[model samples]
Every structure is written in C-alpha cells, then in structure tokens.
Target: MINYNPKEWFTFIFRFHKADTFRKLFPLMIAVSLYGFILAYLELEYWSLINSSYVKNLSLMHSVLGFVISLLLVFRTNTAYDRWWEGRKQWGALVNVSRNLSIKLAGYLEDESDRLYLSKLIPLYARTLRGHLRANVNSDEISDLVEIDKTHIPNQIALRISGRIFELHKQHKISSEQLIILTKDIDVFTDVCGACERIKNTPIPFSYNVFIKKFIFFYVMTLPIGWVFSFGYFVVPIVVFVLYVFASLELIAEEIEDPFGSDANDLPLDTMCNNIEKHVKEILN
Candidate 1:
C-alpha cells in the first residue's frame, strides 16, 4: 500500500499511483472522446439522419441504462469490497493464532530446544502462507526451519506443528487432553489458510464482468448520440468524463476483487507478514 499523510488532499488527487483507475482508463477515455467527436460532427453536419425517429429511439436506451447500470456497479463494488475486507480479516486471524500457538508451546513444552523449535515454526507457517496465497512459494527462507518436502507448504507446516503437539503427548510433556487442546490451534491455522485460499482461488464471476463491460461500452457509445443533440461539441468533454467514471469504477472492481495480489489496492500481505514475524519473535524472546 502507498503510505502518505491523509491531510495532503492535493497529493491524493494528483498522485497517479499504479492502482489509480484513471491511468488504466486513459486509452479508453481517448477512444470515448474520439467517438464523441465523431458523433458531434455527424449530428451537427447531417442533422436529418440523427433527427429521424429510429435514431431518436436510441435515446430511450439511456432511460433504462442509468438506473440498471447504477445497481450493477453498486453490486460489483460491494462484492469486491467484501472480498478485500474478508482477506484482511483472515490474515488478522492468522496473526492472532500464530501468537497463541507460540505462547502455548513456550508454556507447555519442558525443553528449551522444543520451545525454540516451535517458536521458529510459528513464523515459518506465516511466511509459507504468505507465499502460498501470492501463488509463489520460495522454500529458501523456510527450508532450514521446516524440514518438509511437500508441495503444500502451509499444510505441511501445520502438519509438522500438529505433529509436535503429538510428540509432546508421547513424551508425557503434555497430557492427552492437553494435546487435544494445543492441536486446536493448528486446526485454526489450517482453517485460516483454507479461508485465504478460498478467496484467492474464487473470483467474481467472469460472465458478470463481461456483461457489465458490454453494458458500459454500449451505454457510453450512445451517450455522444443522445447528448450531442443537446450539448453540441461540449458533449466531447462530458462524454469523456462520463467514460472516466464508468471505466475507472470497472478497473477498481477488477483490482480489489483479488485482494491477495501485489497490486496497490490489494491487502498488504507482505507488511502484515513482517509484523507477524516481529510480534511472534518479541513474544518468544
């Protein structure tokens, strides 16, 4: 995420961050403007054709479009925001559960080496989950910490952690019931990982996206026709601005729909991971 002072309103308005919708919609904005110009010229130069009943019927399309498209945009934005917020919540849970696991192990385990080993594993699980959600796993950082040769790093990490709890039970460091209680934390980690994976894998329906884009396209294209009759050449800027609003919203929806990504609008997974590491280490120390 791009961090800056919230009071700097001018910077907020002027800064063109990579995730800014305007930058993504620039080419489409130009196209819409050019189309507006063409419509204005044609309507002004050849008044009779656009003045005909059939061409006038196209104005009715706008009547229904404004209300229907507004609803669709609202739905699209709401859904994407829900996903983004849920992703953050899941990661927050992961952070809490990591701390809990560390504290439990440190208190229950008799051996200092066992406590240290489990403390190291808490962050390893977090690091592995971060890479897992990003769809790019690098075992180099965790290879020594977790001696596992498995594709699903998060699950493998959880398995090893759970296995440690069982190991404690076998050594009588923790009783059978205590073993069950501690294992629940690993289950929480598994559940958190599952929830994150669900968000990362499942996205907004593609057909809905295509339909909304098509609707926006046809609606914007017809704007020049309807408005040019009333607004004249001024419709060029009006149409361009309208396209910017519609296109920018669509672009934003796409960006936030997948919250685990490295995109500017995405949840700050990397920062959260680092913070989790720091907090877990602080507690262990």
Candidate 2:
C-alpha cells in the first residue's frame, strides 16, 4: 500500500512507522548489542594462527548453512504471497457475484411494485455483504436504503433478502423453473460470502511463523561474526543493512497477511463495496 519511489531511502524507512504499531522494530534493537558482543568474542577467540586456520576451514560449512537459510526465507516469502493472492482472487469473485445477483434479482421481478422492492433490496444485500465481510455491519448506515424491521432481526439477513425472491414464487408469479434459476444465483452469492470469510478468519499456521522469525534472528546474529575478520568495525553498518532488509520483508508479509485490517497495506474493501453499490444502482436506474 506504500507508494514509494525507488530513489527514496528516507521514504522507505519512514513507511514502516505507518505500519502496524505492535509489529514495530524497537523490540529488535537488542540485535545490535547482541551482534556486537558475539562478533567481538569470535574475533578474540580466532586471534591465534591455528584457530584462524580452523575458522577458514569452517567457512565452507558456514557458507552452506547461509545458503540453506536464504532458500528457506525465499520459500517463506512465497507462501505468504500465496495467501495474499488468494484473498485478492476471492474478492474479485465477489465483485462478479454481486453484479450477477443484482441483475438477476431486478430482471426477474418485472412488476412495478416488485421492481421498486428490488431496487432497494439488491443494494442492501451488497452493503450488508460488504459490512459483514469487514465485521462492521452498521445498521444505521444501511437504514436509509433497506427497511430492517423486526423480522430481519436475530439472524438470517440473507434469508430476508431471499424472502423477496421467495415472495415472487409464492404468489404464482415466477414459474418453478425460473425460481430455481434465481435460487442458484443466490447460492453462488452465498458461496462468495463464505469464501471471503474463510480467508479473513484463517491464517498461515503459527508454527511456520515462529520458525521463520527464529531463523531470521539467528541468521542476523551470526552475520556480524561471519564478517568480523574481513570487515572489522565496518561490520556494524553492513549488519544493520542486512537485518533491515530481512525485517522489511517480514513486515511486508505481516501486512498482507491480514488484508482487511486498518493497515495501509490492507485491501481497500470499503472503497470496493461503495463502488459495487454505485455500479449496481446505476445499472438499475
């Protein structure tokens, strides 16, 4: 959600402050002290010629470990992206389902009375779906459009919307065949709702999350020592830079994981719902 120019380093770092407050990097400040002490210990222990020679032999082993962790990090990032992409696809389906259901509801009920009834009801269904997806169903926000009376209380807002379709059938209005077709559309719309809820409620497994976090921290801690013999005090900025890259990616994955949250990176669900309402009303009018 951050619109950053590639040339702007200040903007990139500043963007993290605007992300989830609880996930900020202040807690990780301990890494600097930890890296410094660990690297200093490694330097002192390897001061002797024989010990330095042994470390040179261990260099190949360290290289192999680093390569493996790099691959694991890449895999972790891909898994996070899968969740984000799936959520976007579900929302795309929601857009199509809303349009189809609205058109069918209006086209089937051709009576002046029924058309007027559907004019209000179809948009209400979309608004209710939008609110329900966000878990912020504001009755008053929808009150001007839909008449939410006693019968609409407790549960089954969808059933109330379907009740309009049901009425057309009960009055010897729409034929049994026509009713079945309309009911199928509603069923698809319901599936859209359920799919969106599934993505919103479920998250990547916690064990994987814990493993990635530990892996990144351990990798970063060892990095300073890995370079101490070569870069000496220059290890500070290099270590910070590497850790920052790793942290930035971790932050990005976290942001997109909850695509409905208030974070800037979250999907623009409110805007999307409003657009659905606007387009539906335009088509009806």
Q: Which stretches of candidate 1 lie over 4 Å from their true place?
A: 4-11, 47-50, 53-57
Residue-level lDDT of model 1, residues 1-285, one tens digit each, is 667788889877778877788877888888878888987898879664656666666668787887899899999999999998998899899988888877776677778778777777788888888888887888788778676677799988888888877887888998887788787878889898889889889988889989999998888888877767667799899888978888788888888988888888788888888888887777666
- Model 2 residue 46 CA deviation in Å: 12
List the lowest-lDDT window of 10 residues for candidate 2: 149-158
How much does candidate 1 score in TM-score? 0.93
CA lDDT of 8 in candidate 1? Answer: 84
lDDT of 2 at 69: 70
How large is the C-alpha RMSD of every model relative to the true structure? 1.8, 4.4
* Pairs with backbone N, CA or C atoms under 3 Å apart (clashes), candidate 1: none
TM-score of each model, in listed order:
0.93, 0.78
